[model samples]
Target: MKILTIDTGTTNTRITLWRDGKAVSVAATQVGVRDTAITGSRSKLDEAVRDTIAAALEKGRTTADDVDLVLASGMITSNVGLHEIPHVLAPAGIADLARGMESELLPHIFSKPIWFVPGVRNDVENIGLHNCEEMDMMRGEEVEVMGLIERLSLRGPAMLIMPGSHSKFVCIDENNQITGCVTTLSGELLHIITHNTILADSLDRDFATEINPEMLLAGAELAKRIGLGRACFNVRTLDQFTIYQRNDRANFLLGAVLGADLLTLKNSNAIRMRPGIDVIIAGKPILKQALALLVQNDDYFSGDVTVVPDDLQPQLAGLGAIAVARARKLVTP
Candidate 1:
């Protein structure tokens, strides 16, 4: 069976085509939609979505009619997306997300049957820490995380951290059920402080910023002591004197923010690991480094840690996972 999956995120739109459960082609495009705060960008968003899907289809030498199933997740269903499908609360799984898609209101541009996966939400005490209400509505990465977990056959009490603009830590039980999770705005926060805020001018554009270990460690320590807001101020001050010139400074700042996030998880007692337990880190390389630092922290180290580079075509992983769910009748066609 041929399946096409789309993952429309804030920064980009990605599509992947799968043949008999293996990815054959994939494509991505920068999002043209601006002002995601309103519905006016819907036209542009729809265009971007179609363009990405069309490109993927072309690369795979297939047409929409050739696709046996279509699946999608991400902001595509938010008010800012092509549709405004509401979120289904947790511990709702893929089944609930698929069911929600059946009733989802979509724009006329989509002629194929598309399944929109809904994010999980809860109002628990930790909700305030990560804005659970907001994080409650994840899109494409949820399936990717679940797929990676299943692919690894990870068993019993696993913690999966997916880092990006909005990082998330998802806890799974032995049955691959999501029991609890937390989200952090570390990526977006870093972007804002370094680019849009006062620190932009001082940042060395050419510096291999991600690998600067000194900056990572400093960032971690600063965040541990002064907190995120104050940490930003410190970066700005150091930038003035070229203190940030030391490659280590940037690494510290990065580490500080990530460490703070890990600290929150630690406080919540969310880092549980038994014998043969696994920690799956999924995301871009820089964020992966931050996660690696966390895993190496003496306070948190227990089980084996495995970092999975996001697959060449993450949308395929997501789509394949959904396909598995559908084949098992966990979700309706």
Candidate 2:
């Protein structure tokens, strides 16, 4: 049977078609509506969603009716997308996520069968005894992670990090069940610093060419001194140097921002998973460099780091896996 999966993220929307236990076709588009004003003004996002699915279907030589199952994860079920479903708290298994989706978000999408993966949540206290709830949610990419795991028939505790607007570190135990996870604001911070903050104009749009060790070190040191609020301005202030030196400065600035995110994740008790674990860094190509930089700088351990090719869209893999599991009744409804 063929399955269609949709992953709507903060910056993009992706669709994938799977058949006979393999991905047959895929399509992606930048459909994320991070700005409240833009999301309110237009159904452009909805149109993009339709277009992405259409492209996938065309490439896969299939239609919506041909799909036996449909699965979705990400912001698509939030107040912003086709529906608004609140997150189901964690210590949750695949069954819980499947059931939650079946009951809450599926009825509107398709009557045949549909699944929505719920985000994981945990409330923990540490350091100052502050009560904080860390929610690890996936809208579209949940299907991708599940699909990848299913394809590999992986049976062990594995850590998967989906880095983007909201970076998530998801943990799956040996039974192929999601145990617990953490979310970081790395992507949002990058967007805010580069676009909204005064630093936007100071840095080049192409960040890939501007990264280096010296810049990373300087950025990390500056962040430690002034914090994120003041660091945003330093990007512009440090731009007085020659063009050759500007790249290093930009790299440092970016590194510091990413470092802050890693520090937050490291300190939070919400992410209590063991160290020296296998990590799958999923997302765009630039993320590979970012992950490498993080490790090189000792932001996170470097051992056993596997960078999954961005070729297979995570949402598609996830939705296709859900569809297959649902078809066999392997996943509880």
Candidate 3:
């Protein structure tokens, strides 16, 4: 089957052309929902989404009519996206997402109808600012989680740590369903600490090319002990008093930021975390490495931890898009 998968995020748009369940060509652009949010117009996003799909097809030497299916996920299904589709409730899997998938004919974007996968929400009702910490939702990560399950052939319950601008920790059941999720803004906070805080110059306003495990854990332990407020100031002190290099300091800062994220994992009721659930950290190598180390050090979990191979990482969403299509019976097994 020839498939066109589009993934839209806050700062980027990506399209992948797949044939027989393998990505043959891929295209991406910096255009994203940020443009729409900034300008209060979807023209730029619409144009990018439309053009990126066309560009991917062209790169694959095919056209829309030749495609068997087109799938769109992420913020594209939000109100500010191409078409808004309400979120699917949690405890969802490929089958649930398949049932909730909305098909629409948008002539401006594609020749055939595009299947939009709704994101998953923990709970969206009856909130009074109390017991609200358990609520979480995800857009594009649902598809990626499906892809991870499909690719890894996961049968037992597991937790997925996808670190990004907004990190997501997705919980899955033995039945291959997404039971719950926990989100953290560690990435966004890391950005602010590095670029917009007093510690910027201490680390030279850049991320570490190569991080130090020792420094990283030192920061993590410090955050776990004194909390982030003082831990952040520790970055300045480490630079001013200690002889750690720029990369080392950067690792310390990153560790401190992600350490707080680990706290969210321990505190989140939405995650439904249990003992012996395997952990898969999918993202940049440095991040997964750091996160894996932290998870190993903490007493919260006692299961095997694995990092998604870099080569297979990019194909996760596309693999997931195919999984949804298969679940919807849009294609043969």
Candidate 4:
């Protein structure tokens, strides 16, 4: 099947063209929901989405009619994005996601089925750090989780650590269902602290910024030894003391943020209570960070850690999984 999968995230929007369950072409734009909102309105965001999709398809030497299915996930289904689809509660499987899938006809775009995959919601009380019943909803990650399950041929339970604006620790059951999840604001906080806060002056947020392994290890060690709140000031102090360059400081800050997030999860009821669940890191550069920390903190993470590159684009796998489930009559279309 020819599938077009779109992911509208907070900082970037990506579109991928896949054939027979493999991604053939992919494209991305900075026209994310938050970025678009700063310059224009919802209509403009929709236009950007449409244009990006067209651009991706054009790159693949195909047009809308050539596509058999269009599957969209991520913030695109959020209230702030293109359309709002109610979330499917967690402990949901491929069939559940397929059953909850909503469709729309874009006569201008294609004659194929366009599905908006619903996000997953964890509404169980007191499941997270707060010790109070807090609801956590994830839109795009659910699809990725499904894709990971099928791609890896995983059975029994698995732990997925997806790092992004809001890193997620998700649990997948033997039946390929999202059992539960925890969201950490580590990425957002890292952005705010490094770019918008006082630490910005000491740290460089540039593409050329290189990772300093030594500083990275040091920062992570500090986070583990002294806690994040106390260790955070060291980013500024080291810079102020001329102990590291601006670029090196950026790496250190990143390490600290990731280390803190890892420590929190290590001690959280979600991870500490569940032992021996294999871990898979999904996404890019952040996967490297998580891998380093996970390997170093062996006592906290006893299971294997596998890093899956972003090139696979789990959203596409997830869409195909749901589509297959629907075809097999495992779910109501």
User: What is the TM-score of each predicted model, taking all chains together?
Assistant: 0.82, 0.76, 0.97, 0.82
What is the C-alpha lDDT profile of model 3 across 17-84, one tens digit per residue? 99987899999999988889899999999789889999999999998889998998998888888888
lDDT assessment of candidate 3? 0.88
For TM-score, candidate 1 versus 3, the one ahead is 3
Quote the RMSD, in angstroms, for model 2.
4.4
Candidate closest to the true structure, highest TM-score: 3
- Residues 1-333, model 1: lDDT tens digits: 887777777778778888876789989988833436545657677777777888999999998788777777777767677666666665645455556664332445456767666655543445565543434445555576557755665564777778777887777676665666677798877677656765566555222245665566676777788787787567667766664573455565577678877776665443333334567787787778677765666355577687775554255346535654574464455
TM-score of 2: 0.76
lDDT of 4 by residue, 1-333 (tens): 677888888877888887776677888888777855676567666777788888889899888878877777888878777767988887788777777877777654445656787888875664655653345678788877777766666675777887777888888877877877778898788878877877777776431155677777777788889888767778889878885687677777777778877765666654332557777777666545545554555576677767776566445444544554454453345
The Cα RMSD of model 1 versus the native structure comes to 4.0
Ordered from best to worst TM-score, the candidate numbers read: 3, 4, 1, 2
- For candidate 2, the clash count comes to 11
Strongest candidate by lDDT: 3
C-alpha local distance difference test of each model: 0.65, 0.64, 0.88, 0.71
User: Which lDDT tens digits does candidate 2 get at residues 1-333?
Assistant: 687777776677777787855678989997765532364843676577667877998999887778776666777767676555666555555565566674333333344455555554553335243545453455544555666675556555777777777777777776766666777788777877766666666766435364576777667667767886677567776786546365665686677777676666556566665666666667777666676567556645644767776665444445444644574474444
Task: Arrange candidates by lDDT, descending.
Answer: 3, 4, 1, 2
Instruction: Please state the error at residue 237 of candidate 2 in Å.
Output: 4.3
Q: Of models 1 and 2, which has the larger lDDT?
A: 1
Please state the error at residue 74 of candidate 4 in Å: 1.2
Which residue ranges in model 4 land beyond 4 Å of their true spot? 35-41, 108-113, 125-134, 206-214, 224-226, 242-248, 267-273, 309-333
